[model samples]
Target: MKKTEKIITNKIKINDRFWGRYLEVVRNHVIPYQWDALNDCLPDASPSHAIENFRIAAGESSDDYYGMVFQDSDLAKWLEAVSYSLENEPNPELEKIADEVIALFGRAQGEDGYLNTYYMVKEPNNRWTNIRDNHELYCAGHLIEAAVAYYQATGKKQFLDIMCKYADYIDSVFGPEEDKLKGYPGHQEIELALVKLYDVTGKEKYLDLSKYFIDERGKQPHYFDIEKKKRNDTKPFWFNDDYAYHQAHKSVREQKEAVGHAVRATYMYTAMTDLAVKTKDESLKKACEELWNNVTQKQMYITGGIGSMEFGEAFSFNYDLPNDLSYTETCASIALVFWANRMLQLDANNKYADVMELALYNGTISGMDLDGKKFFYVNPLEVQPEACEKRKDKKHVKSVRQKWFGCACCPPNLARLIASIGHYIYSQKEKEVFVHLYMGNETTVQIANNNVKLTQQTNYPWDGNVSMIVTPEREESFTVAFRIPGWAKGTVMKLNGEIIDHIPLIKNGYVYINRKWQENDHIELSFPMVVERIQSNPQVRHNVGKVALQRGPVVYCLEQVDNGENLHGLILPRNAELKANYNPDLLEGVVSITGDAERIDQTNWNDSLYRPVEDKTTSVQMKAIPYYAWCNRESGEMIVWVNEKR
Candidate 1:
């Protein structure tokens, strides 16, 4: 029997409350508030404005052409969201709205090939001439992803045909063949987008093109610079972006640390992982491993944030994790999830999932406000609102989420991530289906030419009693791999309501259960949610005197608004009794900590920098919320890691 045929996969069906949160945010907040704010920020006199941009530089224009990048990505994200919702609720209103949004996008794509507004509207005579900077390829990448997602969601081919034309057009433009001009996307997303195109159409060309881009990238005789010379590369693609980080000195894997444009680096790494998985290339896989180690071990924040410096908005140094002035972009964290999840597929490692979970819980989710209209570009851990203003060099580190942004990356980026998250749940090779994330959702996927229904039932990240029911097409023995989270201390697995004994729960950081599953076989996993105090590695000097809290996947932090007075003065006194409570009335829905943080008072009004008055202890109530939800409430002080009260 085929592997997928042997095991039945069941899933936990996600209702509106589960899957609709981010989508609802997109519909209610993103469209009306942020998108317009972004459009308003763009220069009206510029050639790239809404009316005259990439797609129709030589022909008649459509509103759909102008909204291609945002519209296509938004449609793709909405399609995913609505499909998940329809699986459970099947709302006509949402379906109608989603259909309309996709309909306009479907109409905008040209017949022979081409879908960009700037070209169609502004300079019809100069479409391909400005491929380097005009976002022609970037637009194609978004449309390709949109086509795949929309096709999967509704079995609609209207937009898919359009993207096929666009992809074929782009594929024709760049390749490994001589005289083909070995050009790659300077922004680095079309590679991953091409993978999505291949997945839907099963066309070897799309996959081949994606691989060519990955192989051609970072090679000597740099394609970007070569293309620059051809176009007279006047200002460079992103005129402001100096091509310092896109090219590589050695091999792609030899590149040790993250460099150059923050978004470009992350997007390239994401595509590399996609290519690695598709081709099963060990060298590419090895490169991904080295890069992951560099990010998590050294260039990562305690709150799972990345990009310590704002200069290029890229990673600067290892252990250079600054709190008050950190440009940990919300989009970068989203990209980290993208990279980490891809790494998870290339191998079965707890560490990959660990970083993914960290980014999702803290860095990624921190992008949006509770109401969803506002968004944070940078998620800094500690905020000295007073100290923040004096820093000239750290201007990119905005402590609060803004209504909209000029670059406008994080909002739509977060939307797409939350929408396509089902892909991160499980992975299957032949016989074994590996369960990765624990969410209350049900999913049906084909493996080994057999249908597997995976139904999960649990309120994860809050409580860890996860029960999975898997059903196979035919009874065949296969190894079912369940992830044992790195944080899981007392892990237990049960089969058919009976506890299984003598099976290893931890192996290379994964628990494997081999069994011949029937039509309905229930597997229960208990991941004990223990309150763990997280301290930085000894190498992190600044975090030595402080400790953060974590129960399950959430990293907790204390803000001055809730604690009152000095946030630095607060601490947990000498192994104080720890308590956790779910405060529904707090910021959205969050777990709040109210178990005594000792306060200190210093009355050295005359001191300048060091010398202070006697340290006097003052016991006070300190409440801690999820680090992601902290800054949305007030403009006061906030701290992620706090002084330990001894």
Candidate 2:
């Protein structure tokens, strides 16, 4: 049978082993930090509502409805994370933390089904009417996802019931029913949440409701217009009334450029793709493709950052790629990963995977410090210290990450994405289940009526050699898919120590090895992560003479902490001596770098328009590290891109 045919009948599983490690990381690294910040912010600071969401999913919720704080998508994602954590495997410490949090949520939730502490305590009278601005639906959407994830992980019904009520409340408030308000979310999260609900509950209504919002968006009686009219405020959301992109004067499909709130745009696109795939809607599919093209081909940064200008922290026109001032929010990149993955499921394509890979290695990971406390909401490639310090607009776009912002979403989101990363690894088309990511972990997915375990052992990104021990329940010949990355210069794949018919994997996209498999089958894949100097697209005018550090999917950067002086001015000479070694005592385990730290005579500051330039070039050993590793030790200078001054 064709490999695709077999997967049509089989269910793939992401094993308990991989998720166990993820839960520990989240419990140890993420939760404690967030909790500490919360304790400092809210005395009643507990991840309670959020905990209940996870607890209900873990089949541990004592109550049907989780409390107020847990009612939203933030809580929903947290729940989803917990559900994933304890799904086939259980972690005691993680569960204990979840219990503490759930009890808090139970206390915070009201009896009337009203939730959300922010509004419950802060603005009780301001519900439903402010649908466009408030995150009620967004929060509900997250709850729905958490419910589904919890149910899937532990077969729990309480959280699902709670979120179902929340979803129903949302559906009742904003849809075309009698006494319903004609509006949609200002932030487009509910649509994706509904998809999750439908998948978990098999409720067609949820799917229909999700499509309704997506279809209703950008039509007359637009959500924002109505919201403005209701509030008697003509001013635009985010204070950008003059900007056409913010209002989206053109149809979403016609709106090629990414415009308005970076997170909102990505969430909307994610919903669009979800609706498109669920219904196979042609127009929606076309719109999705068009928008994808617009973002990838035009607005995206070499590091895969989307938003350029800080005014909106959103999309601008083509070739407006500026290095000095960028508002490429980390969540946008995470959302990009979500949208791209959804697109991949709809149609087997390389572009989606390519973007997904790019965003994962650079933009998404760039959100947090290597130790995990510090975070960067906006990731900009180029920064001049004067521009950073003197420019108020640019000042908001931080050159270094900070510990927990009040508008914090990216950090937890990053943790969750990294933890649940196995979902992105293997995708099935018929009998052929494709392995797009090469991380060391054991995964089990049902393929062709039997459980197929992929014992993938590899030190990837740093090293390209991957070996997968394919263990199937029964003797079967099918297809095993491997993503050939768009960045791979050369890749080789082998099965059972015998080279398959060589499909020269250009860019290392998916290389499918279709054949019969037996017990103890071995597959070896290798892609040399050659340290290479990369030149950006010529249209990206700022990076014309500059070179980016790259090995595998990661784009490395040099910080002034390790190597000081005129970092932005320093140019890495072509064929400059390159050597890489691991510093175990460094931030978050092993870090690799090339090019010795070179120093130059300090520029003398004179009270003249132009002072006599120093003619001395002082040579010292220089080194580079991952961008995420900066700002941990001291407030030293950081450079994502360095020039090789000849």
Candidate 3:
């Protein structure tokens, strides 16, 4: 079996108009602000006693443990973001802070390698007793990820060693062995993190442990049930023993549709793909493919958001996506990106990369405000401040981003993803390099026993023109594949100032260019950046007669600040001439979509709840901004889907 290839995070440097600013915000603003939030220094926001829990466990503070049981994962995610920031540019103060945190972790860890501040400080004897809801293993998984990332970024092994010890302890407690407890995480994360540990340490036990967790899930006489029975606790399960909520309903190989909590489902799928590639498990690979098709074809939003309902923060029936009541949690989309990238590794298909890019540009980044200090846990397609405030069903929807949350998972998750944006741009095999995303960056890839330097310059998402220069250490024949996005049409290519008149070799979704490279060969690609009106399938009842606006990879939304107070009453004409204009002075410089449309006038209703139907209409010019940039200015009603006057 071929070894799975990974992008070396430290080798790639991002410098793009779209992503560069996000990276800078993650480094300079989000990271420091989150650090303060973790330390409980932000008096204006909800208290996050994450760091204090650690201090209590380390015996540095005598305070009682406060916050959610999963609070420790917040710090873990922040640490992972810090590692990525340090990889982009070193800061001594940040490093010192991370180092001090690591020292505290060492002090907090028990002699048996048991870690997790919740159990350590609050319930010492109850460790591993409630794997169903305690989130102990889930927290451990995040800590392991932070450890691996920090070690990779700074060449520091102390954090890694601490996590390894903790992992070893976990490995001892749960496995197929008669003495070990047969349990898996209710929240599936440690399985994926263990794969990262195995990649770095080359320890087969880590890989085996990850496989054990995946294989043991959803088996007969489920582990959650067994654990519950052993405790003899009569409390009803929060999910009413709906094992699918945790994705533990059946074996992973037999599960076809995406079910359960959106984040947990995606995380488990990511680990399954990772293990399938590593161990050459054909069944696992097939299961992943079926699940992938189910998600992207039936369950996904146009913005690549998942998890339709807020009831369980989980997926609903197929094509049941509601524009206003959607609970597209930010972390779910980020995890979707993670799963998609791993799927790309398993197969260099453009479908995965396309969804990855969709989530990055629209759903995931929409969770964070432009300044990066504020964040949204739910990325709704349409929002009305009054509805959110007055309606019980719309209570979860927020028209504006908040400073912080008591749950607080999405903020740090967004931070780490934006900080590590370089990892998604390009991937490599022994002699093949696949460009998954069009981001301006420079990086070196080892191909065919030689170093190849590649630099890309593009104003993607705003303009579709891309220019690339390839420089290898010496003349060598290799293949470079550029992804032709699914949405892009009438693409043109030029190699070294000469047009390729003949049909180019296209595979999956990439144009393949294989040749013996010279010192400074140039490649240029142009994709027609035309505004498109997208209509949902008839099965999606909510969007049947409506259309959404999209240009390039960006999804556009109509805001009250630009359109009017009643955005829902606006109707887009069937033949409206939609134009894309780059407004540097608006919404932090976005290409806004403008068109002449009509709105139903409600001026003469005159205190009547019900009135005779009439076409009391007025002409208005509609403006749509990038979905990610909405609500960054004034707070008002926002709608992605506009009624079409067909």
Candidate 4:
């Protein structure tokens, strides 16, 4: 059986140069800042009203509910982040606050295990009536996730039991049975959350409920259609009764192409993959693989972002990625990571981890500012301040990150993901320990009757020199697999100080070192980090003549501040000498790539918007920063794919 269990965040002690800072920022800055925002106390930030709704639902206040239907998720997600932070580093005060909130949740929950603030506060009798457009199940999913995290971190069953009661109530309400509602979430999240609940409590019913939701989605007559007909009222549903936009146009097994809201699609696919792996269902597994390939090979941007168009925040078509008009929501990119990580658990494929790394380093990190306070809900590859200001359609493309969002999903989502990033670094099977991602960390793994202590040191995603030390309680024979990233070529692994003469075993982009180890045995792996030019497929019309820069896993982009405005006019020379330089003062000390390029003197053409091709150009020195590090400095145009001299 493949390894389905991943190492938890608490086990891996991160002390690295790059990712450690990010995690620390989440712990110290983002969490507190978001806590204030959730309480509607953050200065100059959009009001969340997340806490006020709970107070109203709990009968602590008579004030009406405010914000969207899914406002509760902001607090739920924040609780999840708090749980992870508890595991990373215990905060008694924070835990006390979380406990108080959980108590409020218990108070707000109805007599029948229902726990939605909007319905409880205003329309108590009309609960679960509009699951298609409303986000009841979606909010419940976040609550369940928080419950599981809190249970795992603090070993407290208060929140877990509250959510489980809600889940059991949900199970009683909807299913394939004749008396059940036969309904699922329009925004697909509870499906995956149920799987997590089952994993934690060993409860078969939660797993069965998740399977029922997946199996019922997009089935004949369409549950959403039936529900809508029953209501017979029009209130402008977000998807406009279009099943494709929510990925409910067809059954899970029949749907092949990636479609719908990117976040919803990825979250549903994650649950599907989890169920498939747990049940050993080959057909369902194949469906996940098909969708995975469709997204990564055809629909995904070079920065590992999805949701190409702004209209629906959805997948448009194959090779239809646009640079400027993109709606790559940070939540969508995070959902992509969730799905890819689950796929890795099922198949142990490097392709999935590659996408995970791409999304983590670029799309996910770019959602937040360097200061960890401001956030970008939509990440665009190309940006022009003028276009953002003047074009009504491009208004979502902000030159700077915002203080808060009305929806307010991405910031908290980023917080939880970053706080729990250690969970994605490693996994374990029967006798093998898999190293999925590299960073400075110390971890202990239990293999059968033995405890193994392993420590790793590296500056990854920037440099590729990793040194690992293995110390088991006793001499034990087990396999330790280190992932040789797909982007890495000419990788070398050495046992102790000398290179082993024996041919190393390689599987799924990992080199397996299985041996009976002593207390202080050492392993070193090196992958040369070189700046490589990446070009899109010829089918991708927008990027046919352009190239993106990549060093290791970090994608680099050209900013107008370094190359002057009108970034589209800048072109890379055929023999451009690109070099990486570590600048301590810029964007918190990133390794910026410097090179020489040419620019057309288009300023001379004062009156002509279009003219005959002229061979007039000027040589210019250009600098490129990590895609995640862009937009941190002065607002200017940015381009990941630069025009290359033919």
Which of the numbered candidates is closest to the native, going by highest TM-score? 3
Rank by TM-score (best first): 3, 4, 1, 2
Which residues of candidate 2, in runs, are more than 4 Å off?
1-24, 39-74, 96-114, 177-179, 234-238, 242-250, 382-390, 504-508, 596-618
Candidate 4, run of 10 with poorest lDDT:
1-10
TM-scores, all candidates, are 0.87, 0.86, 0.98, 0.98
Q: Candidate 2: how large is its RMSD?
A: 5.1
Candidate 3 minimal-lDDT segment of 10 residues:
1-10
lDDT of 2 by residue, 1-646 (tens): 1111111211224333323344466656765665554434434333334433434434455544334432345544555666565653577776665555545555555565555655654466777666665677777666666667666666657667767766776676667777877667766787888987887687888888998877766776466676678778866555556324333444565665577776778787888887777776778888888888888988887677887877766676678877767788888888889888888876667778888888887888778776566788888775555667788878876766767654656766776676567667667765777776777767666766888777877766667788889888888888877777777766777888987755753333567666778888998888877777777677877777777777777777776677764676565667677776766567654456767534545555544556666656666666877665556666656666666555
Give candidate 4 regions above 4 Å deviation: 1-9, 234-241, 501-504
Q: After superposition, how far is residue 215 of candidate 2 from its true place, in Å?
A: 0.8
Q: Between candidates 2 and 4, name the one with more favorable TM-score.
A: 4
Which residue pairs in candidate 3 collide? none
lDDT of each: 0.69, 0.68, 0.93, 0.89
Clashing pairs in 4: none
* lDDT against true structure, model 4: 0.89
lDDT (tens digit, per residue) of candidate 3 on 1-646:
4667676466788889889989998998999999999999988899999989999999999999999999999999999999999998899999999999999999999999998999999899888888989899999999999999999999999999999999999999999999999889999999999999999999999999999999999999888878887889877677755889999999999999998799999999999999998999999999999999998888889998999999889998788899999999999999999999999989989899999999999999999999999999999999999999999999999999999999999999999999999988888877889999998999988887788899999998899999999999999999998998989988899999997742458889888899999888999999899999999989999998999999989999999999879888999999999999998888778999999999998888888888889887899999999999999989999999999998
Error of 1 at 315 (Å): 1.1
Please tell me which predicted candidate would have the highest lDDT against the true structure.
3
CA RMSD, predictions in order: 4.3, 5.1, 1.1, 1.5
Error of 2 at 578 (Å): 2.5
